[model samples]
Each structure stands twice: as structure tokens, then as C-alpha cells.
Target: MENDSVEGLKKYTANNLLDFLTKQIDKDLMAALVKELGGTVETKTNSESF
Candidate 1:
């Protein structure tokens, strides 16, 4: 099952992978609520990070 998921992810380009991961992080942050940690989360794009 894990291998299948990995194989599926392999189809994505580097930019797509970064975008997907960023969105996922944003979702997690929203769910967790950064205010609880006394901080805010900034979701950046692939180009913005570099």
C-alpha cells in the first residue's frame, strides 16, 4: 500500500510536489490553529522559499 502511494506520488513534477506539500501544511496548520502556539504559519510557494 505504501509502495503504491509512493509510486503515485512519483508522477508529480517537482513544482507540483512542492505545491501539494505546501497546501497540506496549510491544512494542518489551520486544523491545529497556530494561535494555540502563539505563532502564525506562513505557507510559501516553491519560488518564494528560494
Candidate 2:
């Protein structure tokens, strides 16, 4: 039972990290697109607003 709980926790943490990284990558891709299109990239800590 303890081992199962530990494994579950690990999986949850990994999933959350993966989601965070995916969002970051998406934001970076958007920034690149904006730069490519000759637009300004204004970065925010909590949100991305151009």
C-alpha cells in the first residue's frame, strides 16, 4: 500500500511538471512567431499579454 502511494505521488508530480513545461514551450513558440512577424514580445511573470 505504501509503495503504491509513493508511485501515485511520483506520477502526479511528473504529470504536473510535464504540463508546466508544455505550457512554457507553447509560450516560447508564440513569442517566436510574434518576433518572426515583426511584432513586439512583452513578457509577463503570470501571463502573456501583447
Candidate 3:
């Protein structure tokens, strides 16, 4: 029973870490895409303010 609990904990920790990494990667990718389209993005937002 104790061993089963330990295994469950390990799996839970691993899954949490994987989820965190996936979100971090997504944010990094979005930032890179925004940087690549910097001027176009800025222009759209700026025009919308009018």
C-alpha cells in the first residue's frame, strides 16, 4: 500500500512538471511569433485605439 502511494505521487509530480513545461513552451513560442510580427501587431492595436 505504501509503495502504491509512492508511485502515485511520482506520477502526479511528473504530470505537473510536464504541464508546466508545456505552458512555458507555449508562452515562449507566442512571444517569438509576436516579435517576428512586431510592426504588424503594433499597427493593428494602434489603429484599433482610434
Candidate 4:
């Protein structure tokens, strides 16, 4: 698996992951996941820059 190999540990986006495999990263690594997990949209109009 990619977790064991240093060469395969490079960062990747959701679109780049394997078709058959699903990977879930922590919020520290995936910020957008907070919307779904926290039950808030956090839309662009919310007046937050980040």
C-alpha cells in the first residue's frame, strides 16, 4: 500500500486517488470536509477570507 512506501507518500487530491480505493484524511489535511462533518455550508458569502 502507499502508506508503507516513502515514494508513494506524496500529497494527492481527491481526483488523483485510485478509482477502486477510497481514502479519508483528517480535517487538518482536508479542510473542506468540515462542511459535511460539522453540518454547516460555510459558503463564500459568509465573509471569511480562508
Candidate 5:
């Protein structure tokens, strides 16, 4: 039971960390694209205006 609990915690932590890293990477990519397009990133609640 304890081992299962530890495994579950590890999986949860890994998923959270992966999600964070993915978001960071996506942001970086978006920034690079915007720079390449010669536009700015304007973030909105439901959409992004460049």
C-alpha cells in the first residue's frame, strides 16, 4: 500500500512538472514566432492577438 502511494505521488509530480515545462516551451516558441513575424504577443483571455 505504501509503495502504491509513493508511485502515485511520483506519477503526479512528474505529470505536473511535464505540464509546466511544456507550457514554458510553448511560450518560448510563441515568442520566437512573434519575433520572426515582426509582431508582438498580445495575450487575451480566450485568444492571442499578434
Candidate 6:
């Protein structure tokens, strides 16, 4: 699945959309949201990889 546009992730499956959201948001902030949701997030490199 490819999120080519700003709203592309909205067209993704639930889990994929969540993953895409996490990718779009700031890692630290998104990780906090994850913790609040009873989920864990990895602190990874912030790179826009192709």
C-alpha cells in the first residue's frame, strides 16, 4: 500500500492508517499517544526514506 497524497492514509486499512499516522506525527508525541492507547512505540530515526 502506498500513501501518495496527504489524505492517502485515510484510504488504508485500520492498522495501516494508524501506522501511517504514527509515521506522519512527531515520534515523541506519537509515542506518547501510543502509550495512552496502551500501545508501545519504538524510538526510531526520523528520516523520510524513499
Report, for every candidate in turn, its global Cα lDDT versus the true structure. Answer: 0.39, 0.49, 0.38, 0.35, 0.47, 0.44
In the range 9-48, model 4's lDDT, one tens digit per residue, is: 3333332333223433332344443332332222235635
User: Which sections of candidate 2 miss by over 4 Å?
Assistant: 1-25, 46-50
Cα lDDT tens digits for candidate 6, 11-45? 33322324766344555555554454444445456
Best TM-score goes to which candidate? 6
| Segments in model 1 whose C-alpha atoms lie over 4 Å from true places | 1-32, 46-50
Clashes of each: 0, 0, 0, 0, 0, 0
Candidate 3: tens digits of C-alpha lDDT, residues 1-50: 22546656544543333334445456444443344432122222354411
Candidate 6, backbone clash total: 0
lDDT per residue, candidate 1, 1-50, as tens digits? Answer: 22436654433332233334445755554523333323333444542321
For candidate 4, the TM-score is 0.19
Question: Using Cα atoms with residue i matched to residue i, what is each candidate's TM-score against the true structure?
Answer: 0.22, 0.33, 0.26, 0.19, 0.28, 0.36
Which order, best to worst by lDDT?
Answer: 2, 5, 6, 1, 3, 4
Record all residue pairs in model 3 with backbone atoms less than 3 Å apart, i.e. clashing: none
The residue-by-residue lDDT of candidate 2 on 1-50, one tens digit each, is 22546656544543333334446667566565445444455565855646
True-structure RMSD, every candidate: 10.1, 13.3, 14.9, 9.9, 13.0, 10.3
Model 5, runs deviating above 4 Å: 1-22, 41-50
Error of 5 at 11 (Å): 41
